[model samples]
Target: MSFDGEQYPGVMAPPQKAQGFRLNHTMLRVKDPEKSLAFYTGIFGMRVLRRLDFEEMGFSLYFLARLDDDEAIPEEVGERTVWTFQQRGLLELTHNWGTEDQDDFAYHDGNSEPQGFGHICFSVPDLEAAIAWFDSNEVSYVKRPEQGKMKDVAFIKDVDGYWIEIVQASKMEGAGR
Candidate 1:
């Protein structure tokens, strides 16, 4: 079950003829940039790594990261704009004024369940602290810190109606399959 990456680094490398590729970021459209920024930055503690304003389009894009390092920005050149930050991973927030209808607008109504795109997850050090922060701030969560089928995993959600899965490693002893 243990992968010794260093021992078999070649196996993990790209094919000899294939170009190198890495996961740059996942972009999600937001109805309100300010509201989305507030939830991501205020509640989740993500920092605004950079901001770009599309003057002709009348929309702004902000890249936020949980990491404090600025060097994590990708060097790849393309039309896809990006914002980089450090956390468990990087989050790219893209706002396209011309393509508002293309945004992912799926949501779980009270009677219906979530389908298609599920939710974004974050690993936290303390589930209790995260839950308390959400509760105190009046943030709604689909499920509080409850025991998952596995040992110590928990979940929560943000104001923009995104679910966050929080896993506490200390509780996951032999729970790994």
Candidate 2:
């Protein structure tokens, strides 16, 4: 079906109560914090905004974001923690204790049989440059831009095997047409 504003109920008439609501973050369970952190920070250029550890629960939560060039991060831990949750487009990685030690440990990538979650997308300014960057880092690809029917889009796998959809808005002029 073609794009239609009235296709979904309540979408055409948004609720007033949800005016102030905004997406804070998306959480993903990871097997190893070090590997996941490296992929997110080193590859994706995200900064570790805040890290919360729960020794009693045997898990940890790492909040990350790709802050603006001139954005000033809070110096103190409490301030940083507060500031992190207030921002949009943040990524939270949760790691359960001892999962890294289990050689067979793996998280559902949401792209295989019995799929549930699909993928997270990143809109890059330059799709070519981003693809080259991924190549330079030897990032595994789920689909190259030219490989699929969706010529303007691409997908790459992260350290935890999660699919990351990459796109350039300008390149997708008539993507679904």
Candidate 3:
């Protein structure tokens, strides 16, 4: 099951000497921390690992992750900050002060014209249950599992309008068969 660079033609292999590399987190600028935090924490079930505020810069960073049941979190703030960076697959929300008060401020979701950043994906244990939960929560959907060519996959919008792809790996295993 190991990766074979030959599978991807013309893709160069990584340097043998390179080490200790991993994707830490992806950041998205949010207009309102309250709404964004609620959507991510409440809807997605992600816990706020750490919140860093900069009074002088008029901004704050909220790091969140879906932790496993056995995962141990440090009690101290300093220790937790160190621990948060060590984990993988984290989402960071950045809120600039006063943007929420402007009444017209918003970030480009990158899914419209001239798209760049596509979407963040979440793998769930039960696709049907997840979709039902989303429906109950009144979450806006771009695509449902049954509506598109790609079956067993769905896309929903966050409060900030960022697309979040929902997938259940077990169901997707039989795709294209």
| Candidate models: Cα lDDT each | 0.63, 0.92, 0.93
Q: Residue 56: error of model 3 in Å?
A: 2.2
* Among all candidates shown, the one with the greatest lDDT: 3
lDDT of candidate 1 at residue 6, scale 0 to 100: 53
**Prediction 1 TM-score vs. true:** 0.66
Q: Estimate each model's TM-score.
A: 0.66, 0.92, 0.93
Candidate 1, poorest ten consecutive residues by summed lDDT? 79-88
lDDT of 1 at 126: 83
Cα lDDT tens digits for candidate 2, 1-177:
955464655566557887878898999999999999999999989999999999999999999998887999999999999888889999999999899999999999988998899999999999999999999999999999989578979999999999999999998888766
Which stretches of candidate 1 lie above 4 Å from their native place? 1-13, 17-20, 69-88, 96-114, 147-151
Query: After TM-score superposition, what is the CA distance of residue 26 in candidate 1 from its true location, in Å?
Result: 1.7
Candidate 3's C-alpha runs over 4 A off are: 174-177
Order of the predicted models by lDDT, top scorer first: 3, 2, 1
lDDT by residue for model 3 (106-145), tens: 8999999889999999999999999999999999999999
Native-to-model Cα distance after best TM-score fit, residue 2 in candidate 3, in Å: 4.1
Q: What is the lDDT of candidate 3?
A: 0.93
- Candidate 3 vs. truth: CA RMSD? 1.7
